[model samples]
Target: MENQTKVTEFILVGFPSHPGSQLLLSVLSSTMYAVTVIGNACMIFIIRTDSKLHTPMYFFLENLSILDICYSSVITPKAALTFSLGKRIISYNDCASQMFFFSLFGTTEAFFLAVMAYDRFTAVCNPLLYKIIMNKRLCVFMVVGSYLSGCINCTIQTGFTFSLSFCGSKEINHFFCDVPAVMYTSCSDTLVNEIVMLALCGSIIVGTALVVFISYGYIIITIVRMPSAESRLKAFSTCSSHMLSVCLFFGTVFFMYAQPGATSSPNKSKAISILYTIVIPMLNPFIYTLRNKEVKESLKKKFKKKGVFFVPLLRMRMTTVSN
Candidate 1:
């Protein structure tokens, strides 16, 4: 490894070939990034200001929105740049930093989703004790604990990855500094690195997925036992949005990282990455708000308060007077 020169920088081969496709993709990527930021920001703002949404469920949702924004930012900007400017050169330190934050926010998102599932479980299976169990302190503790755990995981993974001697190829065949992509460029043995990555990341992904599955299992049983159709429907409605979110997030993640070996093409991986990083963040706000009755009501009340609903009516009356 010492015989080969150490790589100080990496050139990312982001979406190679097809100039027309790249241009279109750039436009789409930029649009998605804007939507992701604004949508998540609106969710956070709405939840914070709406007193009615001050429950453990919304609290965790707000945390998830924030995480979506953060995790998307770590990957989307570089991807967008690749499309727009075709500038894919990244410094070694910058690559490491990107990987660190990506891991941190990504891991945090996984845990937060698990916590949200638990919140839903409590709300459905034990409604009477939901407020008592998911108190403010516990909520704060869960959020803080997720971040702390992410930091520790990121530290271990990033330290091990960068410690290797990267000698041969500095050109990564992906948009951003993904762990596997970077590892592929190393001249030194990546057996331990790959093993460690699989162990840590697999645990986080599989563990959270199991928790969500179990929570939903209990929720399903509880809903089925309800005597009335209305009661079951109402209970299921509360969980539908969360279930969609969990499926979208975890499905793409598992496909991208949790596979036994790399069977898919790099282009397929990139497409999946775009789905999880760009599309999912933008979709979260719409999914929760459009599907949620409380959120819709809150939005209507907010718009009504600001005279958004009445402005058109007033304008019509003024036009009639002028005529």
Candidate 2:
């Protein structure tokens, strides 16, 4: 199909063309985007300034929070702009770049969550050995490792996706430059590309999900076997947030990637996209930090010392709910 005419650009029809609904969605997403940035930024600031928050858990927490910021920034702004301007055309190179960073941040977030799961396993399984296992050097290595994995996967996926020649309809039915959605616009046979996608993206999703599930599974067992009710409850509470976050992140990811080019309606894909790209990032800080008492206390103390009069997006909501 080398002789087939190729598409140099794709027009994204992000949301439905209904004026009222488009207006409502743009407003809602803009508000969510603002909240996502503020929440994640607050966590980053709190983790950075607080000496008490300088542990491995909080260190990973900081990385996660920042990832949320970057992750949301990737798709939300462009999405909002697309809705507002009513111009959703993206150049091939620009689309490739957007998909690259989106995948990069997204994959990094998944691995980071897995790393956090491992950290929790250490904290719960061997509290004493946690220090030894999760030291500064190891933490640094983990962060670096996650970033590297993300970059490699992003490069592979983006390279392959962009290499495919687009010979069919130039209209992309989704809000953002998702790999599968873009692949559907290609007139070239994407059999090899599809296999590469399964090997790289599919493996990451399945492998990471397995690791996280196993980690939490072991954690639940350990928590149940604990002698003290208080200890068990606290451990369970801590794991709940991470577990919920994992489900939200991976559920949408699996749904989108597992079925490549299955967009019956662009609106449905936009709705699904909201779960992982927008909503999950906005919720991650709340899951990882706001639910933890230590993080709250640190934030409160820092706010008091700085005399900062910022509205509490999320106050210390540390309830001792049993697992």
Compute the lDDT for candidate 1.
0.87
**C-alpha lDDT of candidate 2 relative to the true structure:** 0.84
Against the true structure, whose TM-score is highest? 1
What TM-score against the true fold does each predicted structure earn?
0.93, 0.90
The Cα local distance difference test for each model comes to 0.87, 0.84
Lowest summed lDDT across 10 adjacent residues in model 1 is found at 258-267
Off by over 4 Å in 2: 1-6, 259-267, 306-323
Query: How many clashing pairs does model 2 include?
Result: 1
Candidate 2 per-residue C-alpha lDDT over 204-266 given as tens digits, one digit per residue, 9 for 90 to 100: 888888889898888999999999999998998778888889999889888777555543445
Shift of residue 308 alpha carbon in model 1, Å? 5.9
Candidate 2 vs. true structure, TM-score: 0.90
Q: How many backbone clashes does candidate 1 have?
A: 0
* C-alpha positional error of residue 321 in candidate 1 after TM-score superposition, expressed in Å: 11
